[model samples]
Target: MSKPTLTDLNAFKAVAEQRSFRRAADLMGVSRSSLSHTVRTLERRLGTRLLHRTTRSVSLTESGERLLQRLGPLLGELDTLLEEASSHEGKLTGRLRINGSEAAIRLLLQRVVPQFLALHDAVELDLVAEGRLVDIVEQGFDAGVRLREAVPKDMIAIPIGGDLRFLAVASPGYLKGKPILETPGQLALHRCIRQRLPSGKLYRWEFQKHDQEVLADVPGAMTLDSSQLMVEAAADGLGIAYVPESYAHAYLREGKLVTVLEDWCPHIPGLHLYYPNNRHVPPSLRAFIDLLRE
Candidate 1:
């Protein structure tokens, strides 16, 4: 019998699991054509067809089904062993890709990432800031940040920051002419700034008071996709902006902005560092999590 390559197995596994070459390629961070070629190469080596592919659908053949059933647990075990081995190694090295919102990255990159990189110079950090949620595994990211421990149970979640609150702030000029909004509904009467998600959808402003929880889809004079830009616009008295209170503090104190509707914006759980529960967490991610914990 001829020996098989690890790449062959990995490619085959991805194709079988996702049932589509395009999706498999997405998960592996390779082009669809490259993934298709890799799978064909594996098929040639085996001298048998493993997947039945049509224009619209792909399915595993009988042989492919048997192979997947056996390889799934084996691959899982290997991943665990790899993480365990790296944990006990003298020097750890690998690239760690983290997906998160722009605001959270800004809050952590300066103080947290530099410290981790200094200790683990062998590791490389890839931080991607996006507004919409994505399938991290399919996007070739090692981990993602969620607003709290609200991520999927299949992922291991570590709370990176403590409680956080959204601050509604505006320039003194803007507020001078507007009536103070006693309720979220009154926000409709005031000009507001809005942000868009990566999915090209606007983020709905969430508010709570007593037993009345309101999600306002308020119209805005200007629509933006960045928190920094939103804050800057609000500082110029364009409208009120909902921003993380932590980032709003400096501007509020420096007279660049004034916070309002403090009682409406209550503190909640902060950002969470999360990754697949059974994934082979590279050394860089493990170290970064530890640093975040400290």
Candidate 2:
């Protein structure tokens, strides 16, 4: 029997891991038909059925499972060794997959990405902007950026940005007839624009004044999933929006929105870049982290 080529092995791995020809094709940057053909050719060469394919799903056969169990770790180690060797040569060249929230992506694009890419042109960055927190390791990401409080305890985390504050803001038109919102409690009396988290739960507005902290489940007439849309809604006289200060900055500067409870909006630990502690840190990711710190 002829030996299976690296392309065939990689195609098999991608399909087996993803369990979907469509998804594997998307990740591999190849057509679904081509990926399927490659896997079939691999199976024929090995003289065994490696996968159980159905219209709706794909599962590995016993042979495929055994092969994956053996090959996965070996391939991972090989990739790591190659990355380390390249790093020693002072040439960082590899894909760095990052999962980040919208706000984190904004900060990375504005501060780190451009400079990092310029310094290491061969490195490919795949930035996935997700609204919800994801398990980076399980999702096949090299690292993730999230609010400091949201990072998992088992991961190694490094703060990538300064402290961030959340502000309660509304348009002048919406505030005209409303009573002054001097305290967080006053939010209940006004029409609020609430934010819905990725888990489909409403995010309680949080505030702090000196030693006192207030978490208000303020009632609202409108709820949105995005901070940018919330700012736009607040600017359009919808209701008060509790958003990160950066998201509302332009509106505040343009006089489209006014802030309340400034004293309570204390700065908190900001975005952090994190990865699993047990994994070998890729040189590309390490370079990016160092750039962020600088």
Top candidate by TM-score? 2
Q: Local distance difference test, per candidate? A: 0.81, 0.90
Tens digit per residue, CA lDDT, model 2, 158-246: 99777899999999999998899899998889999998999999999888989999989998978999999999999999999999998
Give the TM-score comparing model 2 with the true structure, all chains together: 0.90
Inter-residue clash pairs, candidate 2 = none
- Model 2: ten consecutive residues of lowest lDDT: 71-80
lDDT of 1 by residue, 78-136 (tens): 66566556657876665677888877687678669888878877676788887778777
Off by over 4 Å in 1: 1-3, 11-37, 48-76, 79-83, 86-89, 136-142, 210-212, 276-286
Give the range of the ten consecutive residues with the poorest summed lDDT in model 1.
75-84
